[model samples]
Target: MKKRVKWTLLSLFIIVVIIRIILAFLTPGFTYESYFHLRQVDHITKTGFLNYNDDLSYGGRTLIFLPFFHYFMAFFSLFLPLTIVAKILPNILMASITLTTYHISHSITNDENSSLLSAFIVGFLPILFSTNSFTVETLFLPITFFIIYVFMNIKRNTNNSFGKSNSLWLTIKRKKYLYLYIISFLILSLTSTLTFLLIIGFGIYMLLSLMENKKINKEELEIIIFSLFFFLWVQFIFYKNSLLQEGFSFFWQNVPSGIITEYFPKVSIIEALVLVSTIPFLTGIFVAYRSLFKLKNKKSFLLISFVISTTLLAWLRLIRFKQSLAFFGIILGILFAPFYLEMEKYFQKTKLFKFKEFILPITIILLLLSTTIPAINASLKQDTPTEEEIGAFKWLNENTPTDSKILGTLEEGHLITYYSKRKNIMDDQFRLIDDVDKRLKDINSLFTTHFQTQVLSLSEDYNLKYLVLTPSAKKKYNITEFNYLSKQCFGLIYDKETKIYEVKCELK
Candidate 1:
């Protein structure tokens, strides 16, 4: 009865998650990270294979990614429209990874309720644009979990002993496991930034490997070398050429600097937490120890080192930007799972009181979820962000002429340029310009009240005609800037909080 009930609940939760996940692709920002990625797919559908060029950019450009995602989207795009087909592909594919997490965690612990908890937590935890937003992180991060699941399952099964009853299952063919691991890693390395991340993750596993197991077999070591070789080779052939062409040296250039120093750490905090808590918190305490001991071998010291390296990398990212702490914690928590479970068992046998077992479990569960809630909130905030916003995008799409050169605010500029098919004097395609930040600052100042005072030449030189302004920008500036934009731009369109206007006109 308990098994049936738990399965039923898990099924229902999965159904709900699938339904809600649709919202991730439905309402969304017009443009975001790797925005050009989807645009590249759109071009390929009309054109041919990747004519990968960063020269479309005036600023320095670096190109990474083997265009696997674009190719993946191209396959699905055969049936669907370009934008929907390209944008929604990543989100849909990752749902499988979530399912993998639930199954993997459940199998490890042999706790049906805990598995259900894992699935619910994974499905519902908000990840800002990642959960739904069309971006690389959402599409790729879940696959890492799925890959880890495969390793764990293989480990679990191989540990079976050789005997009359178990011989059928305990075949422990080292070559087969080696091939699977190598192939999985090689394939994944082509798709995204898995190279650096998996190194950190597997390093954690190596720690576990050494703590109880002997030195890695030749086969396993060979698998590791092949995976590394493939990852580096792919980058060399595809990403490296593009960067060198653009005066770039390393792969990080492919990832914008602002992304790493400014945005990533901040965003990663929320992203890491949601992914970490996909498994229930307290269940590890009651179930993880048995599995850990069962898996522990002469090579346990290797496993310890792996755990320490992964923890250290995660901490490095966190110290650079503290949000990364959640992922580190989740991983360390998993590493410490053995102790947590042993303690749970010890306390249960102690039997301090009738309700103590229940209270302790509930307390731990609450604490874990709390750690991730801020990230969830952050994700939700990114989805809509602010209310008093025009996203001039909607108006620019509907109202602007096809070829009109207009000035738009940073958020809405790219939207108008892309969706409206207009030639913007400046758009938020940062890679397209030499001075990305300077353009953003100048464009932003145009919306404030004092926009007229700073850039009078824009009116005459750029033929600045149409303008889109949102309350969000108005509020961002102090009294001086707000007053300038309000007085100068003739209100061509206004409704409730949103406004649209032309700089050249006087309203009737």
Candidate 2:
């Protein structure tokens, strides 16, 4: 039975990797914030690790952005080309997540087939599939599950060793487990700010355990102290990197605010059902709550922790729309394992037309299809910059100075920085810089104002060196060859068939 489970899990992982490769091929360019990360990886390859002074964005400013994911990619880029590494790394990390999901679910339910089913569910979750490209969230998924799995093992050991006299000598002997937990915590903390949410979940579990026992266990205290220490350390690094002048104000001013209603805004009720697979999630929650009071069922505590932590972060707007949904999907898979077993038993007892023989297989196939089809279709339709726009960026790379700062739409800022290796005043990564509103207003005025003086003033204020007008920008600003600025401004350096232009004239 164990061998069969292993084989089944291996097969699911292969399927996930294959799908990710197919998506990577179908969608050629990076998506969204991936360009920023690609640039960071390039930086790491040139310089050593942990160099936070990114000269590409915000006109030669420093950022305290997380570097672990980029560092990981850089290590791989040592031997292979970065393009190849980027294409396959996310899929590899995602496969690891599938394996970790299976182990976590099996630890909770001790059922092989059900655990494999859980792995299958997570492997094909629509949100996971959608974000499985080169992104930090993809890396976060497996680390989050691995941390929970380690925590569960620690709790099980402590529970089994209850009243066994945990002396200092015993603590000394068990230092390895403590080291493992601390290492995992550091990885999660250094990888992203999202680790704070995981720390909150661990705190809740510790609080619940204390309420029941009236005292903290040795393992629990160690975890709490280690987590608190690292949390403070991460915050300190952020402050120090921000030069302590901005302090926490940097984060407060930069991170955008949004309401919880924005979570999964594009997902219809049907898609939500398909993403979460309503029956298993509902059944898992029911079973977990019913088993909440059982002494041996400590696994239920972690399940509850997942639900509370993810929901709280979603409500607080700490995570993005798809990210919140993806985390919930993992929780659903864990809970669904036990629910599947219960249903299997029911089918066997009632002899319900041999339901047990086909039910699990049919459900897995349907769930996989629901997510896989949508993800592939979405990948095929994913939008990227036009060839002309890319050509304009390439021309800038060859013609402009390395440190030149350009003022353009936020949509093009990332591409400008990544492809041209030049500085952009702002980009879609608004959370990483300060004065987003003011910078956006400046860009808006530079494009929309009909007066050449205002345009020159805005350019002078931003220390602008060049202007790139893509087709979208031209259409939006209604710019033509005979525009007023064209008569007053300098000559165009590069013009593409797609009507994209790179102007070499000064504003003032």
Candidate 3:
């Protein structure tokens, strides 16, 4: 039975990986975020990897964004093409998450069937597949779960040895566990700010355990305290370097302040739930809550802690609905395993159908298919930049000087930086720069204003050398041509095939 379970789980993992690779091929460079990530990889490949500043965006300013994901990809780029690595990295990371999910769930439940079911759910859940893009969140899933697994195991080991003598030598042995826990915690906290919320969840778990047990688990408490201390110390470094100031200011300006409902639309919230395998997830939540009350064991504590932590973060708008939904899908799968197994057992004993054995597998298949098919299809069919747009970007790369600043709509800013390797006045990453509103207004005036002097003034102010008027921008601003700036003022160098235009004369 164990052998069968192992083979089945391995088969499922291989299937998931094959599907992800196919999807990666089908949708090459499908996401805008991928371009930004690819650019980072390219930068790392060129340079030695200690540099954090990206001179391509915001007119050659220092970047405060986390480089963990980029660094991870860079290591792979040594053996493979950067493009191939970027395309498949998300799938690779997610596949690891699937394996980790199985071990974590199996550790908690001690049921192989349930653990296999949980692994299947997480490996192919549509919401998770959809979010398997080139971003920090993609890598966060596996790292976060691995940390939980380590934490739970540490707690389990300490609990099993509760009566051991508190000798100096024994204390030294336990310090190794603390060291492991602290190292994992610091890795997560340093790599992504989203991990901070996971730490918050750990705190909640500790508090709830205290409420129930009337005393904190000393080992868990020590790990949590050390995690918080290191997390704050990392934040202090970011603060001292002025990186936190830039990020916080950007967040304040862009992220709306309000309740959760105000932040997410009804349709989006609905989509998030459905994408997460809604029925199974909700069922699992119910089961987890019931189990939490009935059994105060380490397994129950870890399960409920994850669910509650993700829920609180989602409720407080600390994470997006999609992200929260993805996290919930994993938890829901783990929690739903036992309930599903029970159902399977009951179905197996039924006399109404001769094929009662097929019931469990069929139900799981249907649930997996219902979500997986739509997500895969949607991912393959997702719209990316047109061929002409790609060609124009390529042209800009060849023609424009490396340091030339191009002024365009915010949409085109990052593409210019990523493809052309030139500086953009502003891009979609509005949160990273100061005075985004003013820069946005200036860009709008540069494109929309009919006055030639005003256009020249805005152009010279930002040291912009090229003007890219994409079809989308032209249609958006309702401009047929550059009516204000004539040939004498600004030479139209490359306007034959592409929507982009280059200014020939240098400004005084």
User: Which candidate has the highest TM-score of all?
Assistant: 2
lDDT of 2 by residue, 373-398 (tens): 76566555555566667777878889
Q: What is the C-alpha lDDT of each candidate?
A: 0.50, 0.70, 0.71
Off by over 4 Å in 2: 161-177, 210-216, 240-253, 256-297, 348-353, 381-388, 401-403, 428-434, 447-453, 471-494, 502-508
Each prediction's Cα RMSD?
A: 6.3, 4.2, 4.4
lDDT of 3 at 396: 82
Instruction: Arrange candidates, best TM-score first.
Output: 2, 3, 1
RMSD over all Cα atoms, model 2: 4.2
Candidate 3 residue-pair clash tally: 0
TM-score of each: 0.69, 0.85, 0.83
In order of lDDT, best first, we have 3, 2, 1
* Residue 98, candidate 1: alpha-carbon lDDT: 42
Candidate 3: give the clashing pairs: none
Worst 10 residues of 3 by lDDT: 251-260
**Two-way lDDT contest, 2 vs 3, winner:** 3
lDDT of 1 by residue, 246-364 (tens): 45323323233443464334335344445454343344322333345664433223233333554565544422233243333333333333333444566677755466558446744
Clashes of 2: 0
